[model samples]
Target: MTTLKEPVLTKRIPTHPWGDPTDRKVVSYKQYVKTDGYKGLKNALAMEPSDVVDLVKAAEVRGRGGAGFPAGMKWSFLPPEDGGRRYLAINSDESEPGTFKDRLLIDFDPHIIIEGIAICMHACRLDTAYFYIRGEYHHQREVFEAAIKEAYENKIFGKGSKLGQINGRDPDLFLHRGAGAYVCGEETALLESLEGKRGWPRIKPPFPAVAGAFGRPTIINNVETLAICTPILERGEDGPKWFQSMGTQRPEGAPPHVPASFGPKLFGVSGHVNRPGVYEEELGITLKDLIEGLCQGMLNGKKYKSAIPGGISTGVLGPDEYDVRLDFDITKYDTLGLGTAGVIVMDEDTCMVGVARNIAHFFGHESCGQCTPCREGTNWMSKMLSRIEAGDGTTRDLDLLLEIAGSMGALPSGRGATICGLADGANWAVRTIVNKFWDEFEAKVSKQRFVSLSVVGS
Candidate 1:
C-alpha cells in the first residue's frame, strides 16, 4: 500500500477552477463588459486563422474535457479545403455525476465561454456554432442565453457586429438546450441530439469531423475546452503560457499543465467535506489534497473510507490510493479514466455495494440503445449489481459481470471514434467496483442471507 503524507487545507481556490464570486450584487452583463472580457476576440481578429491554431499548439493548451485530446489537433481536423459549412458545437451538457465545474463557468462567466467559442469558430473557419446546454439547468440556460443576447446587443457576435468589425468577418452562433440525458454528454450522441434526432450514437471511421450533424463536418468540444480560448488568445501565446506556469513541474506525476498526450483536468470535490465545491488545479494534486484539504475533509471530523474520483465512470478509490495524484493516467494505480473530473467522496458510512449499484443503475438508463453491446451490457451490469445488493447474487454472478464487461470493453478497433464512450465507461465502472470491492459485496450477501433465516425463525 502507498502511504501518503497528510494533506494541507486552504481557503482560497485557484482562479481558473470555477473560482468566480457567485453571490454578487452587480449585474453580470455590466460586470463582463467592464472587465474587458472580449479582449481575446479582439486579439484573435488581428491574426490569420491558421496562426490561431499554431498559437494554441505552441502554448500546449490542451482540452479540459475527459479525453484530453489536443485542442490544436482537434482544430486542425477541420477541413483544409472548404468542403462545406463546418460547425462548432460546445458540449455544455454537464450530466456526468460529480462533474459540476462547467456549470459554474456557464452560471457565472457565460460571456467568457461565448468569446472563447467565437474565437474558436473564427480559427476553424466555421460560420455557425451551437452552445448545447443541458435542459435541467434552466437557470444556467437563462443566464447563458441572456449573456449571448448581451454579447449580440453589444455587437460582439452577430454578423456586422463589433466582433465582426474586429475580425473582419461575420459568423453565426446559436444556443440550444438538450433534454437531460447522460448519453448526450458523448460527442457523437451530442451531435445526434443537435440534429433533432433521438440522440443515439453513430459508429465511427466517419467521425463527426467527416460526417456530423446535418451531414456536415463538425467539432464537438466541452464547455471548459472552449473557455480556455480566452486566456489562450488574450495572452497571444502568453496566455496559455501563464496557465502552464502554475502546478507541479514533474513530467511523470500526472500530466503537468499539459502533457504531450493529456491536458490539465478541471476536477471538482464534493461529499462529506468542509469546502465541498470545485477547483481547476493541475492533474497531479493528491486525492488526499482534493478531498481532505481542498474539500475540507469529511464533515464534522468523520472518517472518509473511499471516493468516486472522476465522473461516475472512473470507479472508486479507497484510502490506499489516497496519495495517488489526480491525472488522466488513472490507468495506473488500479483506477480507470479520470473522466469529467468530478470527485464524489464517501465517508465511512457509505456502502460500497450500494454506491456501485447506484452508478450501474445510472448508466443503465443513459445507454443510447444504438449498439447491442452497450444496450444489453449496461442493463445486464445494472441487474447484476441490483441482485448483489439485494442478496440474491452468487459467486457466479460476480464472474458473469466481469465477463459481460470484458466483452463490452473497447473492441480492437479498426476505426477510431466509436458511437460514444458510454459502453466502455460503463464497463470500466463495473469492472473496477467488482474487482476492488468483491469481498465487501460477498460479505453483504452472506449477512443478508443470515438475517433472512433469523427473521424466519423468529
Candidate 2:
C-alpha cells in the first residue's frame, strides 16, 4: 500500500492541476473554480464545435485507454448533428489489471473529469454523457455522484447555467455502475452494458460514431482522455503544442509532426517496485529511467528481471528491453505492446512460468464466453500453464500452448478472431512469457518429469 511519490522529472507539465496530490480531501467546486477549472468549458462553449475538435487534434492528445487513438480525430468521426441526439460515454470501468489512474482521478479530482465532460459535451453537441464506472469502485462512484450533484447545484448542468446549456437545452450527465466485468472496459461492450444489455462487443463497420447507445451517434472516450480536454481547450493551440513537445518526436517514415506519443501520462507502477502506486510522467520516458530513477530500483535491492511496461495486456518486456521508450511507439519494438500505462515490475526471483499461468487464469475466468477462440483458448492456456507450474506438464504441452495461442490471433498482426481485446491480452501474456522465457518453461517440464521418475523408482 505504498503511496506513489511525486514524479522525478524536473521539467514536468502540470498534472492534477486542481487538487493537491498530498491532500486526501476531494477538491470542492469552489476550490476547483479558483484554479480556472471551468475555463476550458467556457472556451469550448465560445468556439464552434469543429474548432474544438481541431484544437484537441492539434494538441495530439491520444486516448489514455491502451489504444492510443487520437482524441480529436475520434471526436471528428461523429456524424453531423442533424437535430438527432448524440451521447458521450466515459469509459470509467477501470478494471484493467495493474491500472488504477482513473479511479484515482475520480477520488481525488472528480471535478476535473466533470469539467472535461462538460467541455466534451459542448464540443460534440451532446446533451447527455454517461459515466460507466466499475461496480467495485463504489467509493469512486460516490465521489462522482457527489461531484455531479455539486455541479448541478452550482448551475453547471441545469437550465440557465452557461456551462450546462447549449442552445437553451440543459445537458445531462449520468453515472452507471458496472457489474465488475473486465470485458466491459471495451468501448462497444461498455455501450452495450450501458444500454442495459449483456456486455458483449458488437462487430464494427457501424462504429460507435455512426450508431451507438440507443442507435444514436456516440463519442466514447476513456476517463483520462476526456479529462485532458480541460487543458487542451485552456491552452488552445498551445495546449497541443505543449503536449507534443514532451513526448518523443514522430519516428522517420511517418507523417510530418506526428508525435510518437504526447502529453503527460499517468503510469500505474506496481509489483515489486519500491513505491507501488500511480506516478505521472511525460510520455516517452524510458522504462529504465522509470525503474531505476523514479522507482528507486527494484524493491529490497533485488535485480530487475522483467516488467510489463504498460498493463498486463501489453505483454512483458525482459530486463534487456528496459531501455525501450515507454510510449505508444513501443510497438515499433519487436514483441512489445503498449497497453494502458500500467507497469507491473518483477524482480529477479520471480517465476515467469508462474506469472504467465496466473495471468492466463485471470483472462480465462474473465472472458465473456461469447467468442470461442477467446473463451476456449484462454481457459485452455490457463490450464496448460497451471499444469506446467504445478510440475505436471509435458514438453508437448508447451508447444501446444503456443500453437493454440498463436491461432487465437492475439498477437498484434493476429487480431480479428475475437470481438474485443480481452483475448489478445490473454494471448500476449502466454506468448511473450514463453517466447522470452522458453528455457524456464522447458526446465519446469524437465524437472517435473525427473521428479516423477525419481518418486516412481523410490
| TM-score, one value per model | 0.87, 0.92
Q: What is the lDDT of residue 129 in candidate 1?
A: 85
lDDT of 1 at 405: 73
**What lDDT tens digits, residue by residue, belong to model 2 across residues 129-181?**
89999999988889899999999898778766665455446888889999989
Question: In candidate 1, what are the lDDT values of residues 1-458, reduced to their tens digit?
Answer: 11212110111222422334444222365776576667788889788888988877666655666776778778887666453677889999888888898887776678778888878887877767888999999998888888888877787677676545322346677888899888888788888899898888777768887777788888888888887777668777576566565443434554445454323445677777777776656666788877766565688888877777788777778667777777665656666666777888888787788887888788889887877777877887788788888888766666677777766644332022235677777777777777877888778666443333322112
Residue 18 shift from truth in candidate 1, angstroms: 11
Clashing pairs in 1: 17-280, 235-239
lDDT of each: 0.71, 0.80
